[model samples]
Target: MQKDIYVVGLMVDERSTKAPDVQQVITRYGSNILCRNGIPSPSRERGIITLTMEAAPNEYEKMEQELKNLHGVTVDCIHFSQQESFQVCQK
Candidate 1:
């Protein structure tokens, strides 16, 4: 119900092989994603992606699950509610 800020950390394995499918899922939820940053491992076989999101709870949860469903992906998240975010800034 409270939609504020959500951070999704995505770990991708075999970048060249798995990225397209991962990308498809991301594109489906593109509107809710505020920004995305992806960094590849030095070997270029793995990647870490961070996404800043603002969306309804269910929407983002679904996105998280979909990413998790991928074979070579790992997902993690951090959430901040609207009031909590303001409180943090004021501190």
Candidate 2:
């Protein structure tokens, strides 16, 4: 089966009020996360966070829903498949 790559973008208007909650939710699904990047405004009032991940459709939707449920936070995601089967390769 093919696996899709999902990129989730999060924007928080109230950083101090919402960032910790967002982080906690992200941490809850850490195993599905491939990478995470966050940028905070100089004044710390707002911020943007990006997460790159590979997970089952249900898992991805669960994460998205959790983030969306947070107050003062906006979430968006893009997912695509490269026509390649997903596999785990160990070194």
- RMSD to native for every prediction? 4.9, 7.0
Candidate 1 lDDT, 18-60, residue by residue in tens: 9999999999999989999999767778999999989887887
Once fitted onto the true fold, the runs of candidate 1 whose alpha carbons sit more than 4 angstroms away are 83-91
**Candidate with maximal lDDT:** 1
What are the models' TM-scores?
Answer: 0.84, 0.82
Candidate 1 residue-wise lDDT at 77: 78
* Weakest lDDT window of 10 consecutive positions for candidate 2: 82-91
TM-score, candidate 1, is 0.84
Candidate 2: residue 64 lDDT (0-100): 82
The residue pairs found clashing in candidate 2 are none
Q: What C-alpha lDDT, on a 0 to 100 scale, does residue 61 get in candidate 1?
A: 74
lDDT score for residue 19 of model 1: 90
Candidate 2 local distance difference test against the native: 0.81
